[model samples]
Target: MPVRPADIDLAQRLADAAGAVIRPYFRRPAGLETKADQSPVTRADREAEEAMRRLLDAERSGDGIIGEEYGEKPGVTGRRWILDPIDGTRSFTAGRAIFGTLIALVEDGWPVLGVIDQPVQRERWLGVAGQPTLFNGGPTRTRACPALRGAIVATTSPHLFAEGDVPHYMALVTAASGGAPRQGPVYGGDCYNYGLLASGHLDIVCESGLKLYDFAALAPVVEGAGGRMCDWNGDPLTADSAGHVLAIGDPARTDEVLEALRGAVDDGIAHDH
Candidate 1:
């Protein structure tokens, strides 16, 4: 079924709720802890997700929930709400405004609506399936880069990638810059990079080690803005995806980037022995 106006509206409200809770903790000394994987989590992340969950439980009790802080809460409806209260926790802790709150509604395992809200920047992007994306109450479109060469690329950080994955990522950076390191593919945007891609300021974002909440809201926003988002292997992103994500502002470059990534994988494997 097609996404409805109400779905989009609800998504906006959800983001707003999360933002209200998160903004107060931003830049302040937050209680931080390391998760099992050594990633950071803060009070801002927990409180924001709790705020959104409270709102969802009251408004749409029948919908399921998948959150970063808390685990899944299943409901009778096949539809689920995915929440990433703080997409760039490290950035938030550092007093950077690049972090965002991601909210998405997935129906029967497919995202139908998404919202990327940067509360500090007061910039929000809302996307509904089969419709144009709205950037801060106005329509937005992705810029076209017909080829991988010279295409601007951004990733959260190279440290997030596994040790074995660095060679593959370096290959992508080379392809994006035509082997010119200074031309393109700067680092450190996280989820904000995807928003930039939707707003025509960026060309590509490739990252690995993402969870459902990390990427659930992203595909719709990128696709709605005339871009394409999928796994590095060029498969459609889903709950079952392997967490390697590739988002491109211009769909034409999808195959080219994928081929480069595939070649990188092959090269890495060949050298493993």
Candidate 2:
């Protein structure tokens, strides 16, 4: 089903609810805990997600929920609400305002609506399928970059990449800098990078080790702003996609980015022999 106005409203409401829960804990110690994967989680993350879940249960009880903090909850409707109450827990712990709350409505595996809310900054980006993305209630479009050379690319961090995937990530960074010595990508921002890209402040964002809650909301925001968000192979993102994600502000640069990644993989294979 096409995304209805009501769905968009609910997404914004969800972000607002999450933001309200998270704001009080910003810059204050919130009882941090490490998950099994060594990722940090805090009371803010848990409480914010729980707040959003409560709203969903009351308003859209039939929709499935897939949250970063809480486990999945199945529903009768094929629609699912994917959420990451705090997309950058590390940044949040350090009191950086780059962290954000992510909410997306995925219907039958495709993201149809998304919201990226940075409560501390009071900035919000909402993207609905078939509509332009909005930043703080005003329409926004990504800047055009015709080529990979000189593109302002961003990734949360290289440390997050798996050992085998580091080279491929670096290859793209090198390509973006025009084959020069790798100057490195803009580090940090997490989901906030995607929001900036939607607002024309960034060009590309490449990330791996993401779950559905990470990129599902991002595709709508990026694509709605005349950009493209896809896998390394340039395939459209879906619920079942592997974690590798590439977001380019200009659609024209899609092929070039994909080629860079493919070249890296091929070079690795050649070296393995």
Candidate 3:
């Protein structure tokens, strides 16, 4: 079901609160710590998440919360909020403006509303299921690209992919370039890539090994902009979806991209043995 406008407003407030806490730490030397997975975390990530949680607790205490910095907090209501306070921590630490705050509302295990806020750049993209995506106070839609060749796909990095998954990803990259090199899939955007895809700047994005908080907010943003986002097998993304995700700005190209990616799935599966 579609979220009410008031709830969407609250989601915006959550993003704003997170941005306030994160902006001061960006580009500054933060106390960095490594997680068990070896991914870096910083004070910015923690404090920002705390800020959003504080607001959620006071306003919608009955809603569940899942955050990157903190552990999950279940609520009586079936609805939940998923947060990545600073989606591109590396970019923020590097003083780049590509970092964003991701806020999502998932009800009954499906995402229904989302926001991608780039605080440094002062750009915001808001999406509600079954409604037009809004970009900085205006409705936005993605650009159309009917084929993989010259589609301008993006991924955060090949390193994020598993050893067995890299070949499959490269196949799609090759398909995008049609075996020739002329601005193929660009790298290094993180959540910002999805916002760009929604605003008609990027055409496709594929990534693996994402958590619910990592990907939940992106689907509504991409889909609300007249795009389609699904798993590698072209299944609609849900709370239980596998980490592999594909977002295509042009709805017409979803099947083609999925097919190209699937062509190497057998190789990926075999290599995993």
Leading candidate by lDDT: 2
Model 2: lDDT equals 0.90
lDDT of 1 by residue, 1-273 (tens): 677777777788888888998888888888988999788999889999999999899889999999999989998978899999999999998899999999989887788788899999999988888889999999999998977889888899888975576677778888888867578666787789999999999998988878889998999999999999988668788777767888989999998887777777555321210
Superior by lDDT: candidate 1 or candidate 2: 2
Candidate 1 global lDDT:
0.86
Give per-residue lDDT, candidate 2, residue 246. Answer: 88
TM-score of each: 0.95, 0.96, 0.96
- Candidate 3 clashes between residue pairs 3 or more apart in a chain or in different chains: none
The C-alpha local distance difference test score for the whole of candidate 3 amounts to 0.88
Q: List the candidate numbers ranked by TM-score, top first.
A: 3, 2, 1
1 or 2: which has the higher TM-score?
A: 2
- What candidate 3 gets wrong by more than 4 Å, as runs, is 265-273
Better TM-score candidate (1, 3) = 3
Candidate 2 Cα errors over 4 Å, as ranges: 179-183, 267-273
lDDT of 3 by residue, 6-55 (tens): 89989999988888887778788888888998888999899999999999
Best of the two (2, 3) by lDDT: 2
